[model samples]
Target: MTPVRLAFCIALALSAAPAFATDEAPPQKATNLGEVDVNARLDEARNSLSPDTGSSQYVMTRQTIQALPLGDSTPLNQVVLQAPGVVQDSYGQLHVRGDHANLQYRIDGVLIPESIGGFGQTLDTRMIDNIKLLTGALPAQYGDRTAAVVDITTRTPKDGVGGSVGITGGQFGTVNPNATLFGKKDDWSFFLTANYLKNDVGIENPTASRTAIHDHTNQVKAFGDVSYLINNDTRISFMFGATNNRFEIPNNPGQTAQFGYLDVTNFDSAQLDERQQEKTRFGVLSLQGKMGDTAYQVSAGERYSSLDFTPDDIGDLMFNGVASDVRRANRATTLQADFATPLGDSHTLRYGVYGEFERATSTNNALVFPADGDGNQTSTTPLNILDSSRILARTYALYLQDEWSIGDKWTVNYGVRADKYNAFKPESQLSPRLGVVYQPVDGTTIHAGYSRYFTPPASESISPTSIAKFVGTTNALPDNGNDTPLAERSSYYDVGISQKLGTQWTVGLDSYRRNVSRIQDEGQFGAAVVYSTFNYDQGKVKGDELTVNYDGGALTAYFNFSYNRSVGKRIITGQYNFAPDDLAYIQDHFIHLDHDQKYTSSGGISYAFPDSTRIGANYLFGSGLRRDGIVPNGDTMPAYFQLNLSVAHDFNLTSVGATHAQFALVNALDRTYQLRDGSGIGVGAPQFGPRRGVFLSLQQDF
Candidate 1:
């Protein structure tokens, strides 16, 4: 069925289902708490003026996600798109800060994947508690991303023991279920969430010679976080996570012969499969003790992480039913220490020094299948054909920062970091950051800052520079070596102002520009150029954003809008112009160049029922984004409207407190359309997915 038809059916079925009974009582009053303003990851005192994390900061509140617009119970990737500076393309990638592709992704301040590259994929957003975007001057402890930074901190239950399960099923055999098990007690806490989604599809928006094929995906994800207080002055935490996903895509796209006519059944569908798995484990121990007349902190940590991807078949070859296979792994360990001091009453200073050691290995092999003349199945690929090789990459970093007090009305922050990569030879770099803030009155501030960044290329994308014969070789060598390389330098400059109008409203404006000298050929370097694991030259990007928020005890709302432009090129590629304008695998001169969007203009009204039940209705309107250029010359789709509702009630059961039952109807008005496309030709069907869906939750506090 066409995506539009699917949206219509979903709308009809929702109207027929029992609507959540509205509780007409006034909403319960609320107040923001804690110095760790989650949205901005800043102190409340500092938040009073510059409150919105809207531009450089992106947040996905759990309350808002449970009521998302997609048909399947909400996925993490879907929630991420709700944040400004994030864009999704036809192939399910999360592009942030205008695709200079300098995205440094991390968890609790540790370098993941070990290589200079990032692990790219669509995550189930339900598994996350918070998502933070750092467009400029990311903390000193975080390193190696040339463009921007993304940090994810999982949720740890606030109440006693409880859990919730949700399932969404509709057009195209989409079946996705997610569940969470968590609990918190006295001084110790534990949390866990597990999810899986698999669906089949029949191709549409057919190209001239392309045939329809069946496609299915099986994805499973799990996350757990446990923490404990060693004492009033100390705390320790540990985290374990896993992601296993496999996609059995439809038939491959290849000509029957290099110079022959097109054939639809030329490749097999069942023969195509892609498997990816990642596992992470880390521990944090921190002490809040005093070192002198002022306060201080000392923390230590150990971490282990791994990523493996094995693609069994490359093209679903009909001749031998065998294709190429590849594998890669990275592991690391580190010792960290930090200190915080006060330069004065008005100015507080914080600085940290840290070191890390990492080990990594990569392998790639292509099997030769001696198939019969007509392309029939023979024996399985050989095990002895193992052409295995391993290499180790090393690195260490040191950083320091000072949060200075300009006076009772102004503050300044400046810091610098240095890093060295030890492999083949040693390459070193220094990154610097500077920021200034001024508070003119009780709850208002204007800030400006600039920072330099560096990113090394991923291991897979780097080719070895030198190789010598291990054994006797007359045109026959036992092994070939691959050298690792680093991505060039990058930098950013930002300026903004924020102010609290009074007791109920706040607004802010921010602008930034970033440039990277070296990009990966695929993940970090000119990764999109020449299809080699090589590096590309100079690329530039810039953008602007604005945010506003209003809250009055019983009511709260926010809206964020951003504009951006990105350009990628082969400026200094040894006089080679493979595709000067193209950013990566995408067409040149044509980039996700510009963007504009606004959100959360909607409002929520909650009423209390006589039996102690509450109901809420929230209206939402989202602007469309482009993976191609922001303004298409011919036909440009603007924006659309949507409504969502949620209801839940609590009742007394015993002295320990009873349970709460809840349900939500997302995308009250199902609107199906394409969101993004990496291709400039616009040949793809605009990127299709599900429409509206339902969700249910049950929780108990004891």
Candidate 2:
């Protein structure tokens, strides 16, 4: 964007901040509406209609996430695309809105300090109950990751002894098996899930011929929460969970273009293997108290994680080294207290504050490998690497939110969070969030919201380790700078309207904006041969979205559209980096790339039957990702459409196995579309993705 245009937008945004401060209406209690608040991004659980879900906090209910189809369950990055205003970043990192990877991933609030080459951490979705993508500012109640925070809460067991076991097999000998167990009582609940699997790839990369890969993985999670009633007004609660993962990529190598592909033909490539392993555990304990019209709660938690990684290759290092093994360990503790006091008969004031302490350490095994003049590998080195470092930090914060109500017509929600870190750069920061809803009639409401939040640098940037082989010397390692601070802040604005339209119909429309300062740029080239990790300049983005939804008796439907206008300028030199680009998807149609959904659209419709039988279908269309057509990895995958359908029969089929059975067919049309070539080094993979597939299972409730 031009300097003049940017300046004008900022001016207009500031001037419009206080234009709609409305608090003169009756507050509507979500007692009946199974509505999820899009504004509270972090607190949408209240609007959720299911009791089996964790809400009023950052909780994801299993029923919802389990229903959404997630492709490539290996990498944790691809699973979060189901939410609004969130998308995967360039490469494989996730970018909340336009936010960068200067974010953090917490397992039950405990931090994971590991770097998968340039990718973030490997996430195990099978053991996850829900994932809360906290992209905005760090709420006072939580610590770390300014631009956004992703809280990955693993599945906890319920009160019964029932678990789900599943196996998904596709092209290239891929197998994913998952299981979940839940146990629940009147005052206690527990949920647990375990998954193990391995995959053989067929991504169309030029190096697909010379590689031999054998990868395996395992994930285990346990959750248990109990609430005791000391009396009627005073109660105590405890929630605890543990999670573990192990991934291994034996010997992943693919030939260069000259070596030729191993398989004559495939949907993509049948070679190229990726291996890794990770594990984490975390839990929370809290107490709730109530006196007269005052209610309060206090809680504390501890988290620990251990991760191990061994990559097969980088760029075209199809030969030479065996593997770059690395390990990361971290632990975190938090203390928070909050209360809600009644203001009067018609209004209530709520406020709270919290303090937290976190510490984490990671060690990278230094590697000694043979290299050519350009840092490309040629030969040598059996075992040469060191893994040990102390990386720690702490934070403190405070926040207050008040919901004011008048007679009937409008209400306002206002809150702000202030945070300060004990380590690294960046000063105390604040996130101010506000929202207003005006109900002109009983079935209609006009709502608008805005928030200002910033993101700090990520854990990886604080200290980076890299090893290089000089032309004549044996091996030398260079330190990635700690000079760049994790300091990036953004101001966001959203406006939309909602209408009941009657008892069976509802609709909404929304638009948003985000401008950030001091975005962390890890140079243009990813893991540059000479420079391990560096910093870059500033960036800006503005976008709009439109959505129309309808929910009725036996039938419900959804339609959504999103578009963004974004650009970045190099601080070192004012030029655009074309190689990696922004948080955009390239293999949109190829291999069903999720990020290509940008400037794209989606719609779905379903109906219910009287005998617990229902059927539905969905449609996806997009503009397709853009790519450098002239480059070797060039070639933009076009847009595509996928159709899916399923049927469930609820009956007393104790004879079959359990309570019910579901037979599902994915890629129902048997229509196979080309996915991105998975072996993307510079330009990315060039092969076709998966093909038509099927999945089946049976379940019983006790």
Candidate 3:
């Protein structure tokens, strides 16, 4: 279909969706609502009956996630990609609204500090009860990481005991087993989940082959929560989770080595055996209570993470003639307090304060040959050198906002935030936020807003690796100086409109623009999976999104369209990671960011049969991702599309409760595509997308 024709159809669907819900009862206004101090709660109520805020937000429930064609093995990133203006990259990271590493995470409205980067998704999908992705211009309550807000809610038991166990297997020698238990006994309640996974395609294939060499992964994760009620309005809770993972870096065969020294022997790059391992653990203790119209929540948490990478010593020495064994670790402690209360009648107040203390250390062991005074001949024997550094940082933040209801047709929210960080230097900023919402009729809502954002550099992102030992090796790059990347500060504006046609259809449009002084980004420059942060002198990003959703009882579906452009000018620091020619080309002109993708669209439709049978399908389309040539990010990859299908049946048994079985086909059409090109700017490891695969899963719940 033509673009204009497709746009017309989407508009029609949005207008027709409400017809399905016309038979349903009308929404009821809360009683004694003003007395409830709605702002005091963690977020919206479980039923989502709160007032509208001027921001673009998408919510997914556990049922919605399970119904996707990916079945039980889907990761959080894949689920998020279904949203507009979201794209997948080489690593497991998600780029939202054309910004890299700008997504912040929260559990039950409490911020979780950034942890060490890893190839595996730290939080398991099986443990999540609901997820919210808030984008565009945000209110004062949301600061730092202004690109997007990922709020996750964990499952909690309201009554008697229940649990489930399942096993899933698929192509590429994949095997996974998981279990979950949740329930309440008197005043005490608990929920727990654990899983283990092993797969052949742990990381993307460096070659175009269907399977990658030595690319295997083993991972285990577990989460547990315990809560006790002291009174009807008071409670105490504790939660903890841990993850361990190991992966072998995929290799490309028949490739020439990049290094040559005194003829020790022939070195092949394709025979490399590289590996990476990560271990992570975290815990949180919280207390929540309410008095009259006032509510409060206090929390304390700690997180520890470590990563180790081992390169193929023999192959690396023959190719680059230098080998490195690297390790890094981080420990973070935090304290947070949030409170909400109702003032008189027309206003509600909410405020919070947060603090974090972080400690980090990096170590590298490199082996290189020593050169003579003439620099003509070097000893074949290798010399071992060490480089290590340890540093500490602290960050503190405060936010306050007031929600005012003006008459019955308009609502306004205004507030400000202050943040300070101590690392390379002391940096701080005061940000102001304002949003206005208008309701002309019963079914239509319009919103507009502006916000100033100050995002401090993540401790893990700015920490420099020890490169002093590689000055004389082939792995060395032109180093002008060591200048730490500055924090990103920007101004954002957004506007949106949403309308309900009748009952089954909902349509919305949102647009946003951002102007930044310094753009912060990270990339891998060595054989390891670790990344280093760098800066772009200036940047501008603009995007627009359209969404149509339908809920027709037996059938549910959604469609999303987004177009975005991201451009940067000049490189401020970290010149050693880039090619000299590419850097020179971009110094005087604006170039597309390495992660930029011009157009993205996603949609899915699912139907449930009366006889316990269900089927669903989904598709993804991308215009193209950025590529690098002699002109520095002046090229683009070929556009590609992907489709997936799934089917399942539910069985009710008298003896075993309920049983479910499902089968899924991913990349069902077997389309081949490249996710990254090694020749691209800032591209470390080239990788291709997965080929066709079939998977099956079985589960029982009681």
Candidate 4:
């Protein structure tokens, strides 16, 4: 079936199910104490499904989130930048621990399938109550996308009917409005949030100018959560989220045309019109309960995402010899179950099973001019070529682990996981994991871990190009090989230590290394903004992170620094995307990945006054990503820094319950920096960082 049909059928099934009815209990009176008790029990059950073990974890609570410059209004990608070992890249991309876009997301201890690649944010930060970033050699339960795990716990229903409304606007033609509603009745509870945003700077400017030409965006996001408490040990919940976003592709003017199109030899580059639209919808239903001394949670989820790129046919053909209108979509359905039980007095056994079915579709209508054997355009007239493909894939994974407390000061966790992928090239693996945590003193703790990992490339990003069809076209490839991408197999090692000084200061240091075969990476090789995956014969990545934090009664501060290096050798797949010289060079020598950065740092400080006022400041620094120089990815750009500040206060009105106002200054120094110079392998265009901007917001709660 088509993605649209599958999505509609799942929505219908979820909607037709019985509402708020419980198998074990009828209906009971709702009280504040009863509600609190039920929520606590459910939270405990959910926690049992995930175990941190010896991994490094960084947590952001609601209060800390609100202390940022934009508070809950901040984009989800920006919010994740504050964590350690996270590097910021163009197009709202985050690379954790020297890896490119391999993060997994979980909501309420349930996995949420990844969506198609796009510039728009699929998940909203406003719905988050708490979020944690888990990294390093992960446990057995965490598989597939394993560079980082972003575990999010959403806001729950309040005691009574209540909601908040807010609006924020600033420079760059920005306008944003949002609302939230939450309430509880009897044994049923619900929470909902919706927001709309319109802005002039939807994407980073390609040039260093303060504003971008033809760059505007409209976005809408909505989320809902509803749950019913059955007796005291069982609870069922449903969550749904949706996002629709549209962006006008920013243009860089004053460029020379390389190719000529029919009757369009003198077309201006600045007058080009290109646009992209992105849409995502997802829903999940889960049941949580405790039988005897064992706690279990089962969930079913479905997600659909699509991206469409409409290009200016004549202008693109004249500039780059090809004009391709691209459409890509993916629909995924998942089922997951986890259970934890105690064995004897010192061991806890945990196990889980997960499965997913996905359908990925790609449609491309490309217009290209005929070319000669010498790669010169021979005709001004363009030929229309249709390239389309669809793929069905399945993945299954199972894990079993035991957490053992050897002594009062030492703990060990060991496990094994089995995974199978049935796609273009079928593969399977059995991997092992081990971790140890020790407390040598009252104020210091140490942890070390090792893990074997197997990661498959994203199904939607693996549409092999037909090299033979475009042999004599302007879009012809330098090479004719089209090898399928293979799953990555790696061994990871990690060690860390954390120490507390007095009662208000804490510091930590961590280091890790990974060695791999058939490593996977992605790049933008086409006019569209979507990414495609490829493989390398061998790869190595290493990184070290340092963190310091202080929390006093009314003051808080934090700092993070990371050093990373990633290199790969031999282009084993997707050979058509690379030039013959670059491929030959890579096959003989190791080269740095395009997204790697040598150094990164982020820090923030905040203070709260006695009069209910707060002020905060934060900064980010990067040594810059790799670019083309003497060799492929052989040079680094100049370093850059950004600073931001905010101040907020609360007011009590005679009629309104509470009111809040905030003012923010972004890029306080108005520094100009380039995120990309359009010269690296698979790098599309030059992108500059945001200039200075001022923003203000007001919110009312009832």
TM-score of each: 0.69, 0.71, 0.92, 0.94
At residue 258, what lDDT does model 4 achieve? 83
Error in Å for residue 576 of model 4: 0.3
Q: Scored by CA lDDT, what does every candidate get? A: 0.47, 0.45, 0.75, 0.84
Q: After superposition, how far is residue 8 of candidate 3 from its true place, in Å?
A: 17
RMSD of 3: 4.5
* Candidate 1 similarity to native, TM-score: 0.69
What is the per-residue lDDT of model 1 for residues 1-702, given as tens digits with 9 covering 90 to 100?
Answer: 245643432222110000011111110111233344232222121212111111234444555454344422555544555554555433344556565244665554433343322222434465565555555445454566544455665665766787666565554466666777788787677887777766653222112222224345566767676767554434456655666655433333342411111233344433545444444444545443334423333445554544454444434233333233545555555555545554545444455555555555555443433334443323334221334455565666777766656546656666787877765567778988776656567655555666776666544334332123211111112231223445567777666655566766656566666776754434211111111243445556666555556555444455555566655554232112122233234323323332223221333445557776656665434455443443231122345555666776776765655665566666566665444332332222333433464655554444
User: lDDT value for candidate 1?
Assistant: 0.47
Ranking 2 against 4 by lDDT, winner: 4
Q: What would the per-residue lDDT of candidate 2 be over residues 403-518, giving only the tens digit for each residue?
A: 66655776666677787766654467878777665666775555555666655444433444333322321233322223334555666655444445556554444445556565
Which is the leading candidate under lDDT? 4
Candidate 1: misplaced stretches above 4 Å? Answer: 1-55, 58-73, 90-92, 100-131, 139-141, 146-148, 151-189, 192-215, 250-265, 268-315, 318-322, 367-391, 423-425, 460-485, 520-534, 571-702
Collision count for each candidate, in order: 26, 51, 9, 0
Indicate the worst ten consecutive residues by lDDT in candidate 1: 14-23
Give the number of the best model, judged by TM-score: 4
- Model 4: residue 629 alpha-carbon error in angstroms: 0.8
Per lDDT, what order, best first?
4, 3, 1, 2
**In candidate 3, which residue ranges exceed 4 Å CA deviation?**
1-52, 261-263, 369-380, 465-468
lDDT of 3 at 417: 87
